[model samples]
Target: MTTLTTKLIQQSDARGSALAVISDDLSLTWRELCDFSLRCSTMLRDKGIEKGDRVALLCSNRPAFLVAWFGLANIGAVTVSLNTGLVGEGLRYSVTQCSAKAVMIERAILDAKRADLEPVLEGRTVIVFDGEQDLFAVLSGLAADAPYEGLGSDPLSIIYTSGTTGLPKGVLNCHEAFLASGRWMSRYLKITEADRIMVFLPLFHTNPQMYAVMSALEVGCTLVIRPKFSVSNFFDDARRFDCTMFTYVGTVLSMLTSRIKTPDRNHKLTRCVGGGCPAEVWRAMQERFGIDPHELYGMTEVGGWVTGNSAENYRFGSCGKARPDVDVQVFDPQDNPVPAGTPGEIVVRPKAPFTILLGYWDNPKATWESSRNFWFHTGDAGTLDQDGYLYFLGRLKEIIRRGGENISPFEIETALLDHPDIADAAVVAVPDPIFGEEIKAVVVAKRDFPPQDVRHFLEGRVAQFMLPRYVQFVDEIPRTETQKIQRRQLQENDRGMIDLQGVEEHA
Candidate 1:
């Protein structure tokens, strides 16, 4: 039930001499990290940051990010981790959404986002951290003090969603929820002090925040931080850090498999974890690297693993079984639990306390809407097998209803990704006069080719009804930081497409 700050102090006291973090050539021992974090806390307190204050943290993936984050939490200030990739309204909305008092941004980020940020942070305290020197010099002349005592359920972070269509909601998460997820990750992945957890994912996301940061502290292991995911240097970085475990964002595995890099089987890396990977990519990684990429289903709201695949218990093409302490069920439109293998909205409820989010920041209506029939509706569509294995079916809103049948874009996208000539693809529903909605496929191809070829390619592979009605070629498909397709952007994009069949492929 201890908070992240308390755990940091405990790790500092017990293993002060142990290496805790490594970012490039520099490294931090437990003691130094704790001392710097304490200094950061003292400095922030002096800057008028008080308990219950929400501070926007805009920074890159570095040790300083952790220091500032822990420092803020130490003083009971909520860390509003904004996505660095967000720009304009998406960026401004995140900062002002929770009435954040200060915007602690990296100088580089501030310089780049000055236009989008300048007006919003006019009166707000804009604390900027450029690099290690700034982080180290924080509370420079002030004495280090113990962290403020707080309950495990105290708000620690407010993670905002990627608002593509609408303003992103700030997810209010507490210490226990974050740590519990970390403990589960540590145990499920079989992490130990000897294992180095490599975090190449964005720090703003749940995987790195909960799995990498919290798991490393829970097990007193070293955290190997990278600025970003690099295809060429991934294995090299792993071997250099002696990292035994690494986490991915579903797309990393695909990227690694797609690239024609030299055989990288000889590394300390073993366990790979995260979700969004197709079965082909999952198997490709296993066959090529001998590491099973465990598929774990989670999000900003749940703050923990709703379903996961591990070595002991796993199912190919499924996002594992519901976590032992979490009740994951699929419910129909009427709010009744659907039978196994029936596609419906994935709803979750924690059997254990402090595992789910406190609420969607200040949006009680959104929270209440999510908590329908005592089960938190995830808004994503999925199904549970008879054995309780969960199969993801994309977002419920993204499910296209042509005539009466609901078609999932994920399966079509996964199929499209298998095309050799096609580099990337996304499926969306277009307005149709007859069928109500028609399936449209937007593709990024290696070379120009007839759009009908795509339909011919999927002839027998997918259901006839699942074949896309329109095929559009695009220069690139926009994706989120985690590499998820930006479906909304595609829906808003004007049509420069070829209609495949003038009729729906209804049997």
Candidate 2:
């Protein structure tokens, strides 16, 4: 009874109850979902996938992702979900990192990136999700019934890092680790059979699948899936599916609020869940969109969600309190615990009854580094208040050390977003001879507003040094498929693209 797996939740659903998942053209219930997953698991096992094997899913958000996540978890096989948006080099990097035994991809998607993927998964099995060589043809024809052998602590996934920093490294999380994440999230979110969570973020990312689907399944909550997040159809999707809760991030909320009209202002969602909400936007978004913005802090390496802004009980700028079973502390350089309100590295240890990830896949150095002192160093800098509310202060690597001042880009970006003409802003440090690094802001201006207007809007609101030297406007900031701005990329690109002559000339 202590052990947890997706099959247990699948079996918990009533015979004819509604538990839905939506792909582009298909929507299915719990009964059908379980059956489909069982069949898929059988086919995969028959194809020599055993306990602890990594099976890469290279398809986009689809019904197959839901089925594959459960089916793999059911049989103790690891599900490595790869983002389909990864192109030539990026696609190759992920596949190579995963070192998966097989990949389940859509033909159209695979065809587009064949040159890159062909070599990476060369000897491995390549099962298509759509077209002639579809997984349905192979899995459906197999015997539907198979003895499920679930491995408790064996690896459940080797999710590759987003490669925003450099190259993507595979983060290995075990079955028990995922089980704990799901259970804790269920408790934190107060998920119940009455709750119908809507998911639109890519399944490849841990948030949507682990926090959204797995957490819902654990509580027997109905799932409303979307292939991709659509700003135009978001509310309509929620209303159509009767979703009580939806997972969100900064960009998703930004997109939702950007439009002139919010059709379903008092929409169905009770709370829009996930992290990275600016404090200024949080109140306005709640007032305008009619949903409580619940924030959570997470990384792919450390299972799914670590902490979340609890519903009903809210914190202004903090992500939230840690789960009852999570051991969290803010530590300085030598790993000594820091005082409240002091920014330090966030470390987490598995509390009793829950499991922690073993390490990063095939990268012993990273594994050792991340797992030092029996704590998972999250590489994020944050402060915990006296009341235990954890305020996120961006990633440690993303923080800019400028003119003896440690500036949080998140603070600058949040400030810029307050501007009327700016739709979104990303701040990164560009090379500066004087201050060591200079602040440069790349903004996505509102369609109606020009770059000059946005630059003028932020002139006096922020400090002279804190203000971005270069304000470059683009149609859209380069972002991961998950909508996180790739700041490292922006920083690298800014060297050539931005004009840093004036502001740093004083420095």
Candidate 3:
């Protein structure tokens, strides 16, 4: 029955002047945070926004975004968090797709997309966070207290997916689902009120919003916010903000590991919880920073994490066992459970009601398709061991098919990453006349390593058929905001590729 407003109010009363949120130039205590959210809610209500109305927030990782989010929750309105990096048609589509009644945005963002946003802003309330029409001024004129009477089933937020494959789908999450996710993550990460967490991932993402922001709020912990992840200033920020815990994705971890070690690398960080930590980089990062790495597995549609590795029970390269409240299984194309140590699609079923996503916003077809056969199909390929640990493979669609054999790109990518010279690698499927699709590896290396050396390195490790037929060196690999590889982009940019085995070109 607990709602975000009730939880925040209770935490404010309990924690009072305790630090709640910290950014580069701004910090707020629990009481202050609650007051700001109340004012924001009042402002929204004053602008004719009613309960269940959609309010779009297009700000970066700052206090303004948090205030807007909680404000929407307080009024029982749905918060549509748009990506700050999105512009033009993408930005317009997101705002319109959700039918947002109002939009609270930074003035800088508005100015940048004034032409595109003008058409979308018609008949909607637009409040700028900066300049002459500052949103803070409106809040300052309003009272600093409001009441919330919302059910746990009330819709809280609509978080859009990365849209790598096509247009982003808005994932609708209810209050109960959001709260349950935070509670689960807090337990998984062993988060406490005394902990201070660093959150540098974009707020538009579910990882930072659900795991870092919500977990901290649920436990009355302090959240140190950064605009975005910066490898150069990560350690410094963690130390400066006295962060005891932080979350990361694989790409950020790789970038951090590639950076030269400095004397100021020491920090108060004790725990790191995130997904996509490569097995090779896990131990090296822990040894270098003295922080425990806890890998997890989940998607935006799952509400939160379905599986996670903990300090008490952790296995290298495994995403840990399925959470007790969730039924996670690997299923074949026919929806039958696969045997242990076999790769298949990962599916999940929630044991508790309202603990997973309500559905895709305004897209019943997608919702029904994902929840077919009474289970949520994740579209990811992975294997479950006899010990119940889940090992994540690449996406099912991304799996490379060679001469009548199914090949996992993740397996080959992991092998390539094990090489000392390679920093990051992505294996993609390229068109082949005979094999249908062949393997093309796009790599980012620390130094110049000949393609022949890469082939030799993979000779004894992977099967001859699984080795990439073509290799291309790039300065950087293209990735989405969430750090997932953009294999489609690599395929589109594969003009000049080095053939390792003198493979014939496809017609």
Best by lDDT: 1
TM-score, cand. 3 vs. native: 0.95
lDDT of 3 by residue, 1-507 (tens): 678998899889999799999987778899988988999888888888889999888887888888888898999999998888887898899999999999988888888889988989999999777722366667778896567987989999998888568888999989888788788888877899999999998887888888898898789999998888898888888888999988887577767766734334478898888888877668767778777788888888988778888666788889988777788999999999999998999999999888789999999999999998999999999999998899898789998878889899888887888888998899899999999998988888889867767777888888989888899999888988787888889999876688877643321
lDDT of 1 by residue, 443-493 (tens): 999888777889889989889999898998999999877677788889888
Show model 1 residue runs off by greater than 4 Å.
502-507
Candidate 2 residue-wise lDDT, 384-413, digit = tens = 999888888888899888998888888888
Q: Worst lDDT window (10 residues) for model 3?
A: 257-266
The TM-score values for the models, in the order shown, are: 0.96, 0.90, 0.95
Q: Using TM-score as the measure, name the better of candidate 1 and candidate 2.
A: 1
Ranking by TM-score: 1, 3, 2
Question: How many backbone clashes are present in model 3?
Answer: 0
What residue pairs clash in candidate 1, if any at all?
none
Off-target runs (Cα >4 Å) in candidate 3 are 131-137, 261-265, 503-507
Query: Considering summed lDDT, which 10 consecutive residues are worst modelled in model 1?
Result: 498-507
